[model samples]
Target chain A: DARVTQTPRHKVTEMGQEVTMRCQPILGHNTVFWYRQTMMQGLELLAYFRNRAPLDDSGMPKDRFSAEMPDATLATLKIQPSEPRDSAVYFCASGPPADTQYFGPGTRLTVL
Target chain B: EDQVTQSPEALRLQEGESSSLNCSYTVSGLRGLFWYRQDPGKGPEFLFTLYSAGEEKEKERLKATLTKKESFLHITAPKPEDSATYLCAVQANNQGGKLIFGQGTELSVKP
Candidate 1:
């Protein structure tokens, strides 16, 4: 079965640390999306890429957060100077031309 | 501003009970409405997608119907394994593959 895979399923870091999360999309998918989920905000889209090029990152904190799809298979989301408020589960989803997306298990991050 | 809202933040049902979850949305132009099931400590899984008003889709024990302003996910004879948070999202015609999600309705089924 084709599924998205994420590395570093759990991460705990102190404030001002850098955290990087990686995702591997299913083969043959062209679109990738990044999302953050928390109890208060629910789920929010952070960024997305189509064909390895970013489509939007408006929801991400530009100064501290960055998302990039270096190639077709690998996508990464990085946070610099992380804060306790940034603690949340980050999810990566991939899809074909259709809008329906398949999500990965997600990376749970905790900042102290 | 485009927004999506789900009612009854949580729901509890007996093993054989049937119930429905509501998702209301307001957007400039509707493209599609999506339903996802999220388990504790896991990512949301795709359930169904409704394209327009009067559209309906079904899978196993769940049925989803969409109208102009809202959508409903109807569960029939839910099992304990069916317990999860049901999320509703909408894609606007103006946005390319971007989805606006609701807070979600947590469903608990007891055997």
Candidate 2:
């Protein structure tokens, strides 16, 4: 079955470290989305790319978080100087023109 | 501002019981409404997508209906395997396909 795949499903890092999560979207999907899930805020869109070009990153912390689609099949979300409050599950989803997104398993990050 | 809200933050049901979850939204113009099921420690899984008022979709034991201001996910004869967090999200025509998500409704089904 075609599915979005993510790497490093679990991560434990000290505060102020840099964390990088990677996603491989299903082949031929045109849109990729990055989201952060926390109990307080629920699921929040951090950034997204359409056809390998970023469409929005306004929801992300400008100085600390970044998302990029280096190619059609790969997307990445990075956090610099990650903080304890940043500990949450990060999900990557890819969709076709129809707009139905399929999500990856997610990366659970814990910063101490 | 566009927003989505789901009622009854949590619900508990016995196997074979039927119930419905509600999702209300307000947006400039609706593109679509989506339903997803998320298990503990997992990403949300796609369930249904409703495009307009009076639109309905169904899977094996689940039915989803959409209206102008809200949507409903009706579960019939639910099983323990159906226990999960049900999330509702809305895509607005002006928002470039970004899904505005609601705080999910956690459903627990007991055998």
Candidate 3:
């Protein structure tokens, strides 16, 4: 069965290093979203894209974080000079529309 | 601000026992309410979606019902496989698919 797929199910990086997470949305899904979950913050929406154009990213940190969809099949979330506070579970989700989202096995990032 | 809140941050139940978890929200308009089950290290698995008040949906031992301001996830005679963190989210029509998630209720079913 087709499902949203994310790479590097786990990641460990030194603080200040550049880290990138990748996601492949389910085939034919038009909307993709990026979310971060932590023990302190619960789940927070970082960004969302529709048909490859970002619709809302107000939840994202503009200074050190960036999200993009290079093409229909791929979406990426990157952090420059990552910090210890950035250590959290980053989830990638997709849906045909806005109501329901299908999440992928999240990428757990540990910044040391 | 639009928000979702779930109650009973955690719950423990014996196998074959039944219980209900709650999700309350404050949003300008409601598009849908969603229920998901998440394992410790995995992504959330979709369970049900309720679109309106008095609407109910079920699968296996899990049933979800929605009302004007809240939703409930009812587990009936649950099994070990039913142990998980149950999450509730709300979608608003103007929110463009953005979901407000509640603090999940961690459920444990022990035999």
Candidate 4:
């Protein structure tokens, strides 16, 4: 059973701190997506990469948030100078050519 | 702009009860409609994908049906273990594979 994997399931940081979340997509998958989920906004797409290249990041805050897929299996989302409003669960999903996304367990981040 | 809306933000049902969740969507062109189940503190799990009107799919106690304007997830005799947030998303014909998600319906089954 192959599944997307994420590291640091939980993180707590003070305001202005930097937070990084990591994901390892399923082997042989070609598309990766980053999403943020909160009670107020539901699920918001932050970024996505296809074939190891960024296809979209318009939903991300360019001033503080960054998403990168260094290689086919690894993807990362980083937030610098994080604010309290940034508290939420970040999810990473990978998809094959068929486009059905498989999501990881998610990283819960709490910024105080 | 593509948009997806789910009705009854929260629902509660007794064990062995039956109910349906609604998801309405508007897009330039529909590529696919997807259903996902999310547990507390976990990411969404893929459930079903409907590609065209009148398509139906079933898994255990859940069945999903899609129409031109909306989709319905029917739960029959649901158990406590079926409690979770059900999410609906749509992929537009022109948006590549990016998904537009709805607010989701949180279902609670009481024993």
Candidate 5:
């Protein structure tokens, strides 16, 4: 079955530590999306890329969070000096033509 | 401002029960509305997509209907496997296909 894949399904880091999450989108998808899920905010789109080009990162905190698609098959979301409040599940998704974003198993991050 | 809002933040039902969840949205130019089912600790699974008002789609026990300003996901005779957080998202035509998601409706079905 073709599915979006993510590594390091769970992580725990001290506050102010750097964390990197990886995703391998389904082959042939043209779009990638990064989202954060929390009890208060629900599922929030942090950033996305179209054809490996970032379309938006405005929702992401520039100082702490960054998303990139170095190639068609790989995408990454990195957080530097992560805070306790930043502890949440980060999800990566992919789609063709950017219509229906198919999500991978999320990476749960816990910052102390 | 573009937004999607889902109602009844949570619901609990017995097996074979039926119910409907609502999603209201306001977009500059509506490209499409999507529905998804998310299991705990897992990313969302795609359900349905509606592009026009009065549109409807179905699969198994789920059906989605769209209108001018809102959409509804109906679950009929639901099973335990149907329990999950149902999310609603809207795509703006001018916004390059980024999805604005709702807070989601958490559903639990008991045997």
Candidate 6:
């Protein structure tokens, strides 16, 4: 069955280090979304792209976080100078316009 | 700002029992409401989507219905494997497909 895939299912990094998480959306899907889940915040939308172009990143910290879709199948979320507060499970989801999103297994990141 | 709220942060039910989860939302315009089931340490799995009020969808033992301001996911005769956190999200007409999610309701099915 077709599904979204994420690399480095887990990541551990020291504070101030740079962390990058990658996602491969399902084939033929044109929209990708990045989200962060934590015990305190529940789930928060960080950014999303449509047709490899970012539609919104307002929920992300522009000073340290960046999201990009290098190609239709590859979407990436990076954090420079990662902080302990950034520790959370990051999820990637993709879908067609106004359709149900297929989520990846997610990358659990722990920043010390 | 668009907001989604799910009631009963957690729920426990005996096997074969039935219950419903509520998701209340406020948005400028509702494009779609989505239901997802998430297991520990995993991503959210899509369950159903309701586009308008009075719409209903079902699969297996789970059924979802939507109204103008809220949605409900009804579980009937749940199994142990049905234990998971259920999430509700909404796509607003102006959000460009960005979903606003609820805190989720953690359901536990006991035998």
lDDT of 4 by residue, A82-106 (tens): 9999999999999975379999999
Runs with alpha carbons beyond 4 Å of true place in candidate 6: none
Candidate 1 per-residue C-alpha lDDT over A1-112 given as tens digits, one digit per residue, 9 for 90 to 100: 9999998999999999999999999999999999999999999999999999999999999999999998999999999989999999999999975489899999999999
Question: B1-111 in candidate 4: lDDT tens per residue?
Answer: 889999899999999999999999998999999999999988899999999999999999999999999999999999999999999999988675999899999999999
lDDT of 1: 0.95
TM-score of 6: 0.98
State the C-alpha RMSD over the true interface residues for candidate 1, after superposing those residues: 1.1
Query: Which segments of model 1 are wrong by more than 4 Å?
Result: none
Compute the lDDT of residue B58 as modeled in candidate 4. Answer: 100
> Judged by lDDT against the true structure, how good is candidate 4?
0.95
Q: Model 5's DockQ?
A: 0.86
TM-score for chain A, prediction 3:
0.98
RMSD, model 6, all Cα superposed?
0.8
Candidate 2 TM-score over all chains jointly: 0.98
lDDT of 2 by residue, A1-112 (tens): 9999998899999999999999999999999999999999999999999999998999999999989988898999999999999999999999985389999999999999
Give one digit per residue, the lDDT tens place, for model 6 in A18-105: 9999999999999899999999899899999999999889999999999999888799999998999999999999999767888999
In terms of lDDT, model 3 sits at 0.93
For candidate 3, report its TM-score. Answer: 0.99
Clashing pairs in 3: none
Name the better of 4 and 5 by TM-score: 4
Give the chain B TM-score for each candidate.
0.98, 0.98, 0.97, 0.99, 0.98, 0.98
Tens-digit lDDT track of model 3 for B1-111: 889999899999999999999999998888989999999999998888888899999898888998898999999999988889999998898778998898899999999
In candidate 3, stretches whose alpha carbon ends up further than 4 angstroms from where it belongs are none
What's the i-RMS of each model? 1.1, 1.2, 0.9, 1.2, 0.9, 0.9
Each prediction's DockQ?
Answer: 0.75, 0.77, 0.79, 0.72, 0.86, 0.82
